[model samples]
Target chain A: MSQAVPSAQRTSLAVPTQVALAGVFAALIAVCSMLPPIPVGGFGVPITLQTFAVMLTGLILGARLGFLSVLLYLVVGLAGLPVFSGFNAGIGVLAGPSAGYLLAFPLAAGLAGALSTVVLRRGQAAAARGAGRMGFGWWALVWLCAMVASFVFIHPMGIAGMMLALDLDLATALGADMVFWPGDVVKNVLATAVAATVIRAFPALALRRF
Target chain B: MNLLDHRPGTSPVHRAPLGVKYAVLLVLTVVLVAWRQPVVVGAVLAGVFGLYLLARLPGEFLAPWRRGWPLLAFAGVARFASGVFGPVPLSPLDALGPALVVMAAVFGALAAARLLVITTPGTELLDGLAHFFGAFRRFGVNPEAAALAVNVMLRTIPWVGAAVRAHAEALASRGLRRGPVRLMGPVLVATVGHARATGEALAARGLPAAPEPKHPGPDYTRGA
Candidate 1:
């Protein structure tokens, strides 16, 4: 486990370990979706920490596991668990306004998770060079990765989903989706902070080599 | 186990093979999304409702709406607005009509999925999924692992909820609970640590994912 160990000595995650981690992380996400809404704005929009959980899963689990976990969560929901926001379930979600966002989540998690792995590996290298571990710079970079995934993947998919499902034009779809931008930004920020703490406590959680 | 409410019965719906039920649901979902005609979606919804009755699963007539209204309302308002305000505006009736049809599609799909769960036992689901995954053996995909992953996900959900509740209570007892963000970090850490422990236990058990992980023993594609 030491850095001095040769690359040949590196341990890859076995199939069972990978599957268990993915499943547990997926359940964590489902629970996050069911967590009580923050009661934001009093209008009953019903915001949950699910978005934060989504981003953090990516940042902490890296690409494959992160993608698998989110995909598992969706499959469970579509198979009839009320694990979606507002406790929605089933394949109908794919044809609804939330379809775009929900479908985009696995991709977004993969993109964010990939970026996080790169950031952590590079950060670990820097730490080995005496820069220390998961510093403020590392946190900011991780946060940037999550934000990039959110902005680049989730919004566009959501808008497209709305346009397709609701028969809306691009302008209208974008307008409707824009309402949640601020909240997404806050969630990404919180996700990075949480992920940073997680990696610090369990360095092997995201990357095996520290 | 109670999460799915799998009512026991010998009805045709219950006796139907899992794959057929799944295929029907999948087909209906795609058709429902593509066809916006209220007449068609309504027919499918009624058919699904009838299946519920036939199965003796008269579980709750209002159950679908209880879980479905929020999603319907959201989609309905958006579809209604889009129709009224689009570049080539729809007539009020046209707008209102398709919007309702789309709502039917959503509800129909949800009900179909619910029906699948109601008639099928959870173990059947796992076996079915494993059988489905068995097709990917050449790609290094372990069928049992996929099934086990889903099984673990089902078991882990409640534990996660309990962990979050415990975290909240502990924070409240110490008066350190501040905002939503505070408990999240600790909950994630605890859950992940638990995952690691579970992974270690699974790895130590090393049961080979069945009679084989890399190689197939018998063709147990006997699907549920």
Candidate 2:
């Protein structure tokens, strides 16, 4: 039942709708970020669902809008919205120990979205090649990409921010940041699984020209 | 859904222009960071309280901090614990100074930001943002798009929140106690489905399309 609509036939949304989608995702991110963090005893770096929402933004919205969605969230929070983790806000939140992770959000979403487009495109090509089994591989690739983005973008920046804001050396900073890895892995895996399930149920979603 | 704690008032702080309030908040936050002294942080915290009072916010406005104080206390204790196990053990008094400073600065910053949010309505905040970013229009930035996004997000927060709660309850009723994780799949499906429907609605309305580039550049960068 899948019709291959030409990219030309698919219309770009109205500016208002695009903005609305971005805003919706931004609010999603904020809600996720501000949810009462799972209290991990020391260092106060609570396990947060912000990363999960970030990955979902990329996987669902594509790159440009994904990036803008996150950028908008950050701008609003910095503009004195009580939307940051622990109900915090202001430019000072960016100056705090968690700044690295916070600042890396847009880049993380952009990377995840770009990687998702590539992976889904390849999956579609493979499916056309009569290799339906490759669908599982593509799903795995989506998860891998999310994990890699977190490691490459979120963790490193977070460690650096911790180092500067908390005044700890590299080793200590790394130690502090390591606490969130397990939770992050779980969150990203869930994000990947959810995205894969949604795309499978709505094949047209995978066919969109990002 | 009640994302902003803003209480309508005719107080001077509430009457001041959004830009001026933002400017004042920025200056105060800068000084707090730069000074990093207990006295400075304490003074700023006091100033924020004064502004809160000036805005005539109800006493309950600070109620959220009741749940927050324990965490702040834990933070101070964690610092002292870290100091004791450090390469060079710090005396309790020495550890206490830095801990208090960190706590005070954080508390002060949070108070100041809350005050801003508490006084400014969400719509006015979005308008201020649109105005603030208007200057960037010359650089190809779109302030209307940005404002629209923020506005949409403000509206969606409650919708998504309710969806999550509803999904969680559905899962729980089905004998799945571990609801949140299991709820993710359904929530994602529903949200993506809603987004697609929204797109279709926009298309059906015949919204104007963005102009195509004359050069017809390579499609390699389509997703980027």
Candidate 3:
């Protein structure tokens, strides 16, 4: 198992292990979503903190890791793990009204993390290593990348699912889920701020190598 | 194999390969989704429940379903209630049937997964995933890292749950655990810190970008 990389490099979390952790995180999200929540009307979709976990998957795990995590969630759910809102599972849920949203999770996380690598760390890391000026700005890019990812990738798919599943008119679904929009905005901002703050306080949070 | 529910005994269902079990589970789920007929759904549920009994799973193993029942009940009731109060003279019964079936199907799936997880140790499951996804190098992921990540993640589940619980318990012991604003702030701060530390520990040990280890398998791709 040893390689030219230092013990730290050779002993880091392996990719397959990352994939499994993603599944576990997905399960955790499902369990957390099951906790009592701010219920919306007839739809039964509540405002839960699970979305934050999804965001965290991307912000911390990076793009591929984040997507793999969500994928793991889907696989387990498909395998009948009660890892969804309301402790629900099975392929039916994946094809049900909420299926689209579920499908979008990995995308959102991946886009967020991947974009962060580009937007957050790309220029700064190169500069920092050259000039020895690594700072919170790099961390801020990671958060900003996550925010953009959610906006571009996650919410649209969720709204699309709501429209298709509920048979709502696009405009109406958009408006109704506007409630989600505001809350999500808050979640994204909070996630960004929290992520940056964590990285600053613990620079190692940004490190993925062993 | 360690069970999350902590029961013990090896049976065919217990010993089935993760991939085969997953394939069966996927096929059943697809069948359930494709056919919405109550008769079909009921039959499937009945059959799965029969397997459950055959597996000799105790009543305790179904406890997680109890946690979800209230939500299912609420969803069912809310749907019916909307039908009742809505200006449209909607029949509550119409909503009731689909809602119940959906809920039951969901419960069925969870029950099945519970059987799998309870019988399989987390480590063994990760090994299964690594082998299952051993072909991911074509897609740019190092198979070994992917496997390691999966294991790390599974190992952290109990720890994350415990961490969250310990924090909540500490707050409760101090007569706190109120207000989403106040409660989530510390809990989230703690979680992020923990997740980061864990990630860093993995990284410090050369995880994320580590070169793949040698293994006895088909050499599908070059390792870094």
Whole-model Cα lDDT per candidate?
Answer: 0.78, 0.72, 0.59
Q: Over the stretch A42-118, how does candidate 3's per-residue lDDT look in tens digits?
A: 76656776777678667766776677777776655554434577655445454344566778878888888777655
User: What's the TM-score of chain B for every model shown?
Assistant: 0.87, 0.79, 0.68
lDDT of 1 by residue, A104-176 (tens): 8988898899888888777777776674554688878888999999988999989988887766788778878
Question: Top model by lDDT, which number?
Answer: 1
Candidate 1, what DockQ? Answer: 0.60
TM-score of chain B of 3: 0.68
1 or 3, which is superior by TM-score? 1
Against the hidden reference, what TM-scores do the models get? Answer: 0.89, 0.83, 0.65
- In candidate 2, stretches whose alpha carbon ends up further than 4 angstroms from where it belongs are A1-17, A34-46, A90-92, A207-210, B56-64, B70-89, B177-181, B202-224
Candidate topping TM-score: 1
Rank the models by DockQ, top first: 1, 2, 3
For B1-224, candidate 2 gives per-residue lDDT tens digits of: 36666778899988999888888877886676567677887888788778878888757446445635664564455445555555667888887787777667656665666677777787788778878777787787776556655666776777777877888889888888753457777877776666556555645755324434568867996697
Q: Of all true interface contacts, what fraction is found in model 2?
A: 0.43
Off by over 4 Å in 3: A1-47, A60-62, A68-99, A114-148, A159-179, A202-210, B1-3, B10-12, B58-65, B74-89, B119-123, B158-224
Q: Encode model 2's per-residue lDDT on A1-210: one tens digit a residue.
A: 133334465455556567667777887788788666654436655677888899888787777778888988889888767677777666656535667888999999888888887788777666766655346778889888888888889999998875554444566567667878887887788788878777777765555456
